[model samples]
Target chain A: MKAAEKRRITRMTSAGRVELDDAVAVEKKVRVAVNGEEVMSLYCSPERVRELIVGLFMTEGIIEGRWCIDEMTVEYGDEILVDIPADGKVSLDRGTLISGCLGGVTFSSSAGGGPAAAGEVRIGAERLRALFAEFQRTPGLYELTGCIHNAAVSDDERIIAHAEDIGRHNAVDKVIGRCLIEGITLEDKIMHVSGRLSSEMASKCARWKIPVLVSRAAPTSLAIDIAERSGITMIGFMRPSRFNVYTHAYRIL
Target chain B: MKAAEKRRITRMTSAGRVELDDAVAVEKKVRVAVNGEEVMSLYCSPERVRELIVGLFMTEGIIEGRWCIDEMTVEYGDEILVDIPADGKVSLDRGTLISGCLGGVTFSSSAGGGPAAAGEVRIGAERLRALFAEFQRTPGLYELTGCIHNAAVSDDERIIAHAEDIGRHNAVDKVIGRCLIEGITLEDKIMHVSGRLSSEMASKCARWKIPVLVSRAAPTSLAIDIAERSGITMIGFMRPSRFNVYTHAYRIL
Candidate 1:
C-alpha cells in the first residue's frame, strides 16, 4: 500500500547497528468539503480517503444509509470534495476533536437518539472465537508501519470489512464508511477494533445500532455505561480462545 | 490510586469462564476554567488534574513557566477552576482535536517563534540506555488498566515525573504540567512516552525545548520532519541496547 513511505535511516538491532531502508507511515492533511463548503481538514493516511468521508457521515448520524451525492472527486495531495445537491443543505461545522494519535475531529450528534440496530442477535462462544481469529489474521497496513491501528466488521464466521489508519477512531470510520457507501446494512454485525473502546466508540456503535462491539483491548467505564444503556454486547480482550463480555452478556452464548 | 476502579466482570481464560473483580481505569470529564472563564472539558484520569491543566498550557504555549495566579482549586467530581489576574487574559479557544483515545483537543500555536529549548546537549549511549531501562521498570497505573498510555520525564539516572492517562497526548501534557508547576526546567531533560511519537508530540517537546525525546514506539514521517527542523534528538523504539535515532543524531554520543 502507498500508506507507508520508505526512508533511509540507521537501525539498531539486538546484535548491532546498521543503516537500512525503513517503512514509515505517511500522514497528510486531508480537507473534506461537502457541497463546496469546507467541513474540516484532518491528518490521515491518504489511502482510503473515500471511506473516511463516508464513515464519518455514518458515525455522525448524518446520512442513515446511502447518501445521494451529485458528485464526488478526490484530488490527490489537495482535498476530497463531495457535491451533494445545494438543497441538501449539509453542514459539517459541528465537529468535536477526537482522541487519536494524528489528531482528528468528528461531527457531534446528540446522545438522545433511537437505537439504529436494536434487534436481538446471538452467537455461540466458538463462533465468536472464530470471528476474532479472522480479525487477528487479516493483515493490512499495520504490518508495514507499527504505528497504525486497525478496525474491522464481521459476521458470525468471517470478517467482511477491515481498515487501518493512524488513529483507531479513523480506522472505525473507514470501515463504517465503506459499508455505507457499499450499501451494506450493519444491523446484525460485530465491530472489532485494535484499540481501547471508549465512550465515543461505543456511541458510534449505538448510533449505527450495531449490536456487538468487540476489541482486543480494554474498555473505559464510560464505554460500558453507554453499552449497557444502548443494549450493546460489549466484549473486550478478545483472544483466539477467550474474551471478556462487559455488558449484555445474554448476546453471547 | 483512585485512577483505577474495580468492576466484577466475567473473564474467559484457556480453561473456562470465571467471574472476577477487575481493576479498570477511570475516565472522567475534567473541565478547566481560566480566570473564571470556561475553556473546555476533557476526559482524563482524575488523578493529577491540576498538572494536566499546567502541562496542557505548557505544551500549548499558553503559560511559559510558572505565572501569576490568584487562586486555583480542584473539586472532585466537579471542575478545576484557576483564577489569574483579570489581565491574564488566558484564552484556550484555539484547540485542535488530537487523535488520542477518549478524544481530546489541543490549543494551537504558530510554528514560528524562538526555540524554547534551543542548545546543544550531549549524552553517552550508555547513559541513555540506563534512562530507558528505568522507564521500562517503573510500573504505575498502566499495570492495572492496559488501556492507558504512560509518559514520563527523566534525567540520566532516574525518572523525575510520570503521568498516565487514557490519551497518550494527555499523558505527555500531564508530565509537562507537573514540571511547570513544580518549577522544573526541561531544557536538558528527556521526555519519554510509551506510544508512537506523532508530529504533535514532537512539536510539544520542541515547544518546551526538551532536547531529547525517547519513545518505545516508532515515529511518524511528519514527526521526524518536525524534529529535524526543531534540532531535537528524536529516538524511538528504545530498548536497553537498541534504538532508532530519527533526527539531530549529534546529541547522541
Candidate 2:
C-alpha cells in the first residue's frame, strides 16, 4: 500500500534469528505554503493530502481570511507540495503566546469554533464502545505497520469519516479536514482516535465543538481540563469492552 | 509524582460500572521565548525544565549563538514560563521549508547533526535488550499513567541519562538536553525510546551522532532510510527477549 512498505529485517528471538519482511509505515514531508509564505513542513504518511492541509490550517488558524479546499494545489510524490491559492496569509503570530494567561493552562488562540455548544444528543456506553471498535477495525494501517494512528468521526450509530497518519495529531487533522470538505457537520459527533488524548488533541476537538472525544489510550491532565471546560464528553483508555469517561458524563448515558 | 496526577473517572467495564481515582499524566503549557521572541509554546510533563529547553533549542537550532542553562529563567507552577536570557534569537525561518528538496524523503533543514558517524561500538543482542529493559523499568511515569514516553542515553553497560514526557519527541529532547548539560558524550551511545521510530525520531538521534537507536515499537520507512544513511544501528519491535534490527546489523552481534 502507499501508506506502508515491506522491508527486510532480521528478527532475533530467544530461540534463533531469522530474516523476515516487515511492513514499515511510510512517512514523507508535506510542505504547506499559503499564498507566497512558506508555512511549515511536517512529516506524515502520504495519504489524505488535501484533508491534512485544510484541517491543519483551519485548526491552527494559519489563514487570515475565508478559505476553501478548492483553492489548494497539491503535488504528491517523494514529498507533498501544497499551495493555498486563497488570501490566507501566514499571519498567526503564535509568538505572542508569551503574553498568554499564566495559570499553567493556556489554550491556543486559534481554537476552532470555540467550545462545543450543548446539544440534545446523548449516546449509550455500549453504542459508543461499538462505534469505537468499528473505528479501530476499519483502519488497516495500524495493523500493517503497527505505528500508525487513526482518527474517525462517528455518531451513536456509525462512523462517518476516517483517516490515518504516522502522527496522532496529523490523523486528527486529516479527519477534521475530510469532514469539513465533505460537508459533514461535526456537531454532536464523536471523534475517536487510536492514541493518547493530549492537550492539543482535546483542543482540536474543542475547536470543532465535537461533542465526545474517545481514544484507546490515556488522557493527560490538560486534556481532561479542556474537555471539561469545553463541554466535551471525554472518554479514554477504551479497551474491547471498557472505557473511562473523564468529562461530560451526561452525554455518555 | 509531579509527572502524573490522580483524577476521578467513571469506568464502564463489561462486568460493572464504578467511579475510581486513576492516575493521569500531567501536561502543562510551556511557552519558550528566546531573547525576546516568543518562539513557541508546547505541552509536556513539567520536569527537567532546563534540559527540555536546551535540548529543544540545540536540536532544532532555534537559537543562533551560544546559550547556557544558567542564563535561563523559569517559573514553575500550573504552567511553566521559560525565558532564554542569551544572545540567542528565535530567528530560524523554518517557514522557508517550502523551498526544500522535493524528494518525499526530505530531512529537516535544522537537522541537529548531519548524521551519525561510524563508531566502534558493538553490542550483542542480549546486552542491547537488557539495556532497553533497564531503561523501560526506570520510568515510573509510564507505569503510573501508561501514556508517558521515556527516552534514555545508555552504553552497553548501563543507562546514563533518562527523561520522560507526555510527548515522545519531548521525551527524546529532554534526554538529549540532559546529556548535553551533564556533559555526557553521545559518541558510541545508544538512544532508547519507548515509542514508534518515526523520521523525526531517527533524525534526532542522528543529530547527536548517536550510533544506535532502539525502540520498543515499530519503525517507519523513512526512519529506516535515515538510520541506514546515517550509519546508525536501528533496532525496533523490542520484546523482553526478541527484537528486530533494521539497519547496521554489524553493530549487533
Candidate 3:
C-alpha cells in the first residue's frame, strides 16, 4: 500500500490560519479488465487496488467458489490496470451502474432474493457498545483525510477484517473480499460500516448472508425493508450505550 | 415534491429508551429511458424525477442544446418509469457508473475539458461566510430525516435553488436540472453541498462551469486536482468564521 501524500494546503482555524502540509488521501482510477475487455474503472485510494477488484468479483459472483483467476497482474505505471483471468464466464458487457457513493458496476440486480440464513446469534447490548467504541477509536485514512468510509467484519470478541475506501460500498466489498480470500467464514458474523445503511449496503450484506449489519448512521426505508426480508439483524445509530435495531431484533439480545 | 414520511421508530437514548415517530426521507427508483431504451435507474427522493433526468442528460452531454427533449412522461404506477424521447442520439449502452454515494451513471468520461468561463467573478470572504451560515441554517429534509444530502446553488445574497436526495451527486444533478429547466444560467454561481468533495463532485461542478464550490466537509486529493485544472474555485470546511480555499483563490476576495 502506498502512503498518503503530504501536500501543502491552507488551513483555517478558529483563532487564526496558516499554511501547512497535510496528509491527503490519494485516489486514482484503476481499470479492472477481465480477460481482455475493460469491465469498469474505480476512482479509489491507491492502496488495496487488488483486494478491491478481487472483492468486487467475489461479491458480484463472477468467481464462484475459490479464486478462479488464472493470472493477475497490476500495472502501476502512469495508469493503473489490473488484468485478471476472464475465464469466459465473467460477462463484461452486462454491467449495470449501481447506486453507490463511489461509482460501482455490478453484473446483476442486487436484490434481496438469496436463501435466508438458518442460525441464531445473540449479541449483548453492552458488547455492541464496546465494539462500537473500539470501532470508533480504530481509525486510519478517515482520520487523515476525513473523507473515507470504512467497513469491518468482526466476531463477538474482536474485529477480524477491516477495509476503508472512498466509497462505502467498496469498503464493504474489500472487507468481504478479504474474508473470502483468507477463507474466513462470514455466517453469523457482524458487519459494521461508517456510512448510512442504504439498500445497496443492505444488498451487499444480504449477498454475504451476514446476520448482523451495524452502523453509526441511519438506514433508508428500502434498507430496512431489505434487511427485514433477508432476515438480517439491522442496527443503526449506534453509540457507546444505545442503538436502534430495525429488524431481526431477536439476534441482538 | 412529496412530503417526508413520519414513521414510528424505537429510539434508544443514554438515559432510557422510547418509541417515537420520526420524519424519514422517501426514496424510490425511477428508471429513465431515453428514446425508449432503459438506460439507467436512479434511487432518489420521490420528487423531481423529471428535473433529475433532464439534468442528468444535460450534464452527460447527451442532448447538446437547451433541452432537446421532445416529450417526457412519468408513469407513476407500481414501478416508476420515466419515458423521454431518445432523440436518435442518446446512447443507452455507453453509460459509466460514477463514484457517488447514491449510484450515478455518466454517459461519457466526465473529464474537466470544456470551454472555460468568460470574465472574472470575485466573492468576498465575509460574504461567503455569511452565505455558508445561511446555508447551514436553511435546512429542510436534512432536519427531518438526517439521512439526505443536499446541493444548493446560491449567489452572494441568498440561495437560488436547492435539491435533496439520498445521494449527494443526485442532489447536485437535481439542483442543476432545476436550474436548467428554469432557464437559469449557471455561470459564476456558487454550488454548495453537504457531502465531502470528491473528484466526481468536482467533475459535476466543472461540467456546469460553476465558478466556486463550497463544502462543509473535507475534499479528496483528486477533487483539488480537478478544481485546480478546471479553474473551479474549491472551498472546504466552510464555517461562519473560516474556510479553506483549495484552488482558484483568486475567486475569493
Candidate 4:
C-alpha cells in the first residue's frame, strides 16, 4: 500500500489570527470484487484496507469469521478480492449492491427478525468511565480533519483495538474486522465510540455479541429501548468521572 | 412545534479535570416521512427540525421549493409530516432504502445521482471567511456538545438560513430542507459546513447547484477532484482572515 502524504496548512482563527499546522489525509480507491464481479467502489485513506474489509464483512454479517474467508487478496492498486467458502446453493444478489465513496456498506436484516443476539448485557460504570478517559487521550485521525469518528474495543480496564474513520460505523467495523482476523473473541469486550449511540450502533454491538458499549455522546431512545430488550449494557455521555447508564445499570457498581 | 428543553452536562477534560461550567443539550426526534409514510427516524436536538426536513428534501431532490410542499406540519409529541405533491406517474422504488445509524448515514450518499446544478455557481473566498467568523459567534448547540456539525446557507455576504446537527451531512440537509420549505432560492447561495470537505459533502453541495462550499476542515482529494470537474469552488480550512480555495480560485479574487 502507498503511504499517504501530509500537507502543511496556514489557518486563521475567528479572531483574525494566523497559525500554521500539519494535516494528514490520503486518497485511494478499493474495488471490491466478489466471484470476479465488481460489487462496489470505495474511496478511502489507504490504511487498514484488510481490517476494513474484514470488519465490514463481520458487521454486515456477510461472513462469520476467518473460517468463511476462502481466499482474500489486496492488490497494491485499487482492487480487493474475497472468496467466501459458500456452498453452491448460496447465490449472490446484485440488487443489494450499493456504491459509497465515504461511508460503509448498508445491509438489511433477515426477514424472520431483527438483530439475532439478545438485547441485554452488563458492565460497571466505573470501568466505562475509565475506558472513556483512556479513549479521550488516544490520538485520533479525526483530530486532524475534525471530521472522523473513533471506535475502540476494550476489556474491563484497557482498550485493545481502535480504529478511526470518517464514519463511526466504519470505525467500529474496522476494529471488529481486525479482531476477527486476529482470532480474538468479542464475547466480553466493550465497544466505545466518539459519536452518539443509535439503534444501528446498538445492533452492530449486539450482532457481534459484545457485552458492553460506551459512548462519549448521548443515546437515542430507540437505542436505549433496544439495549434494554437485547440484554446489553448501554452507557452514554461518558466522561472521565461520570456517565449515564441507560440500560442494565445494575452492571455498574 | 415543541419547545426545546435544555439539559445541563458537566464535561471533563482528558486530564480528568472537570470543566468550569455545565454544557446544555437538547433532545428531539426527527421523523422523515415520504408521501405520508414514515421512512426513517432521526433523533437530534430540536433546534432546527424545520431546516433539517427542508434540507433533506432538497438534497434528496424530493421537492424543489414550497410550491412542491402541499402541506407541512410539525406536531409536538408526535412527528413532523411533510406532504410533497406526488404524481401517480412517478413510482418510488423501495430497493434503495439505506440503513444504519448516524455513522452509517454519514458514510452513505444519496443514490439519486450527482448534484443537480454542478457547474453554475461560485463565491469569493474572502466572503466565505467573513461568514465563518460570523457563524462562530452565534451561540448555538456545538458550543455545548463540542461534537455537533453546523451547516449554513448564505448569499454573498449574508447568511439567510443556518442549522446545526450532530452529524455534518444532517446539518447540510437541514439547511437545504429549510430552503425548500421556506421558498428560499439556493441557486445563488453558498453552503458552509463545520466539518471536513469529503466527497459526500461536496456531492450534496453539487446536487443543490450551490456555487461554493466553505469548511473549517480539510478536503479529501476526491472532493477537490469533484469540485474541479463540477466547476464548484471548494474552500477548506476556512478562517476569518485566510482560506484555501482548492477549485476555481479565479472566483475568490
Candidate 5:
C-alpha cells in the first residue's frame, strides 16, 4: 500500500507564489469489525494493515481465546474495511480502557501491567548514538512526507524491524505487532520512536516488555513516572551528539 | 497551575553521564464527570482545566441544551478531578464518535460538516507572515518544556486568545472552548497551531468554521482533503519566509 501521494500545491514565499508537487502522508480510516459487529475506526497510514490490526488486538486485549489474522478480510478504497473473526469472546471495554487524546492508555501504576523485564543489555553511549543515527537514516515514509512517525525495534547489533504510520502509536503498534506475529521476542530489545514519550507511548513499551525506550523528542512528566515504575530504560531528546537518560541509566554502559 | 516542573535527569554524551535538572511537561489525568456520572479521562496539561473541558464538551457535542463551565469543579493533585453539573442531558456516544489514534473525528464528506462559511477574510501574504511570526514569538508552555502544543485564535490585527496543552487536539479545544465561552466569533478568525495538520486538526477547525488555518508543520493527505471539503484555507510548513497552501487559495490575498 502507498504510504504517501504527491499532489500539486501552491507555495508562497517573499519572492512570489509557485506551484509544485508536494508529498503528503496518506491516512485512511480502517473500520474494524469483530464477528460482524462494527467496532472502531483506525486512522493510520495505508500500509501495514495486518500488522496494525494484530498489534492493536494483542495490545488492546481483543483476543480472548482463539483468533487468526488470515480469517480477516481487508478491502481497500477511499476507506479501508476490515472484518476480524476471532473465535474467542472479545472484550468490549477496550474503548474505555484506552480512551481520549494522545492515544490515552491508562495502566494502573502499581499492579497493572507489570514492569518490563529488567534490562542488562548495555551499549556504550557513542555506539548507541551511531546506532540511532543509522536507524534514523534508514528512513522510509518520513523522507517522502515529514508528517509520518516511525517506530523500530533493534538489538545491540543493528535494526531488526520497523514500521511507519500517520499516527505515532499506530507505528509503534505496527512494529511491535509484526514482531508478535513473526514470533520475535520483544524482551531485552530497544524500541525507538519518532515522537514525544507521552504516557501512552511509555505504557505501550512497558506493556510489551521493551527494555529501552528512545525518542528524538522530549518526555512528559507522567512518561518519566511510568518509566521509573515500569523498570524500563527511558531516553529522550536523543540527538546525535548527546542524549538524556530519564530512568534506568544502567542500560547505557 | 504550573504547566511544567523541573526534575533531575542524567545526561549522557560521548564524554560520559552527568546529572542535570530538566523541565518536563506536566501531564495529569483529569477525570471528567458530568452530572455525577464519570465520563472520560482527559490526559492533558494541568492548567486551563475549565477551558479544556469546555472546548472538549462543546466540540465533542457533550452539551445537549443548557450547560455552563462555571458549574464545573476541578480539584488538583497527583491526578486532577473534575465534576460538571450539566443542566442538560449529555450524550454518552462521544467515546464512540471521537475514537482511536491522533484525535480522530469522523466528518461525513457528503452532508457532514458543511463547508466553512465562504471565507472573505483576506490578509496580505506579508502581513500574515508577520502575524504568524509574532504569534509564535509569544511563548507560553512550549518555551518551558518544549513538549506542549499551542493553538491561538487570531483576527487580522492580533492574536485574541490562545491555549496550551500536551495533546494537540486538547490545545485546539482549549482555545476554541475559550472562545466559545467568551463569545468570540470564530467565523472570521485564523487559527495558528504548532503541529502537523492531521485529520482531526483539520476537522476541528472545519467544525468550528475557522476560515484560515496556519501551521509550522506539514499536513496529512486526509487533512488536506478535509480542508478542501470544508472550504478552509490550509497553509502549512509555515516557516518565516515560505508556506504551502493546500486548499482555498483565495483566502490568501
Candidate 6:
C-alpha cells in the first residue's frame, strides 16, 4: 500500500504568511451490494471501508446487525460490493434510488415517523455546557479539508463514538453503525452534531432510540416540534457557557 | 401581508470581550409542486421564492425554459405550485423527493457517455483571470453569513447572472434559473462556482451546455475525467491571479 501524502498550504495575510500541512484525502467510489445486487455507490476517503460499510448498512436500515450480512467485499478501483443473505425484506426499485449529488443511494423506507420517545437518558445544565466545550475541542476532519461534518455519541460526562463525513447525515449514520458493530447500547447516549439540528437529524436520532440531541448550530421549528413530541431533549446553539434547550427543558436543569 | 421581521443576536467575543449584534436569519420551508404533485421541500430564505422556483426548475432540468411553466403560485405556508402543460417527456416521481438541508438538492444521474462538448466561446487567460478577480468580490451572502456559495455566469468580459445559496449547487441552479427567465443564452457563458469543482458540479454545467466551469477549490479525478470527455474547460483551484485549467486549455488562452 502506498503511504498517504500530506499537502502543505501557504497563505499570505496582510501582516504575514502562515504554512499548514495536513493529510490529503483521496476520493474513492464504493459500490455497496446486497444479495448479489448493487445497492448504492459512495464517494469517501479510503481509510475505513469496513466501518463505513457496516455503519452505512445499519444506519440506512438495510441490515439490522452484522449477522444479517453474509459477506462483504471492498474493491479498490470503482466500487465496493457488499453481499448479504437472501432476505425477503431486501428489494431494489429504480424509483427508490436517491438521485442526488452526494453519495447516491436509497433507504429501504422513508424512515419517517417522529422523534423517538425519550427514555432514561438525562443531563444537567452544567453537564450539557461541559459537553459542548469538549465537543468544540474534539479534532475535526473538516478543519483539515475544509469539508466534512462530525457526529458524536456521548454520555453525561464523556463522548463514546465519534465519526466525520462530508455529509451530516452520513456522520450520524457512521456513529450509529459503530455503536451497532461494537454492541453499544444507544439508549443512554446523547447525540451531538456539528451541523444544525434539522428535523431529519432529530428523526434519525429517534430511530436509534437516542434520548438527547445537541448541536452547535440552530434548530428548525419542525425539529423542535418533533423533539417535543418524541420526548427527546433537543439542545441547540450550544456554547461553552450557554445553550438553548428547545424541548424537555425540565430534564436539563 | 405582514412584513418580514428580522431578529438580531448579540454575541461576545473572547478578544477584549467585544460584543457584536448580527441579524438572525428566518428559516422557512417551501414545498415545490409541479403539476399538482409535490416534488420536494426546501428550507430557504423567504425573500426570493419566484427566482428560486424558476431557478430550481431550470437547473433540475424539470423545465427547459420559462415557456414551459404556464403559471406559478407562491403560497405562503404550503407549496410553490407550478402549472405546466401535459407533455409526454415530463414525468414526476415522488419516491425520489429529497429535502435539502440549507443548500438545495443536487440530483445525480448515471454516468453515461462522456464529458460535455465545449462551446464556441473562447477567451484569453488574462481575461479569465480578471473575471475570477471580479467573481471573488461578488459573494455578498458569504460576506454576511460566512457560510454560503456563489455562482455566476459570465461572458468574455462581463458577468451576466449571479446567485448565492447555502449550497454551491443551489447557486448554480439559481443562476441557470435566472438566465432562463431573462431569456439569456448560456451558449457563450462560462460558469464560475465558489465551491469545489466536483463531478456533480461539472455535470450540472454540462447539462446546460455551459462550456467552461471554474472553481476556487480542488477537483476530483472523476471530475477531470468527465470534463475531458465532455470537451468542457475545467479549471480548479482558481485564484484571482492564477488557475489550473485541467482540460481543454486551448479555449483559455
TM-score of chain B of each: 0.84, 0.89, 0.85, 0.72, 0.89, 0.77
Q: TM-score each candidate.
A: 0.86, 0.90, 0.88, 0.71, 0.91, 0.69
Q: For all the predictions, what are the DockQ values?
A: 0.58, 0.65, 0.50, 0.20, 0.72, 0.14
Residue-wise C-alpha lDDT for candidate 2, range A47-159, written one tens digit per residue: 98888877877676666654556657889877888887654346565311111111232223334544454655698888888898899889477888888999999978999
**Which whole-number lDDT from 0 to 100 does residue A112 have in model 5?**
26
Docking class of 5: medium
Q: Candidate 5 chain B, which ten residues in sequence have the lowest lDDT sum?
A: B99-108
- Count clashes in each candidate, considering only residues at least 3 apart in sequence or on different chains: 10, 6, 11, 25, 0, 5
Tell me the TM-score of model 1.
0.86
- Write out the backbone clash pairs for model 2: A78-B104, A79-B104, A104-B78, A104-B79, A112-A207, B113-B207
In terms of docking quality, model 4 is incorrect
Q: Is candidate 3 or candidate 6 better by DockQ?
A: 3
lDDT of 3 by residue, B64-146 (tens): 32224335788765357988654345543223322211112223323235565432668778888887777777767777776
What are the per-residue Cα lDDT tens digits for candidate 4 across A1-253?
4323444443433444344544545555677665455545566666677788766754554432122342565776543343433222222321122211112223222211344344244445555676778987898666665556788998877889988765677678788878776666776788888888766788777766777788888765556666777667776777655666666555555
- lDDT digits (tens) for residues B106-134 of candidate 4: 21323345444443444444566677777
In order, what lDDT does every prediction score? 0.73, 0.80, 0.73, 0.61, 0.80, 0.61
**Model 4 misses residue B13 by how many Å?**
12
Candidate 1 error regions (>4 Å): A13-16, A34-37, A61-70, A78-112, B35-37, B62-70, B78-112
Cα error, residue B164 of model 4, in Å, equals 3.2
| Candidate 6 lDDT over residue span A176-228, tens digit each | 76776566778788999988666667767766667888888766555666677
> What is candidate 3's lDDT per residue for A99-132, written digit by digit as tens?
1111122233232344764346688777877877
Report the Cα lDDT for candidate 5: 0.80
Q: Write the per-residue lDDT of candidate 2 for residues B102-176, one digit (tens) a residue.
A: 123222233343435576899888999899989988947787897899999998899999999999999999998
> What's the true lDDT of residue A53 in model 6?
68
- RMSD over all Cα atoms, model 1: 6.3
Interface RMSD score of each model: 1.8, 1.3, 2.1, 5.7, 1.0, 6.7
lDDT score, residue A58, model 2?
69
User: Which 10 successive residues of model 3 chain B have the least lDDT summed?
Assistant: B97-106
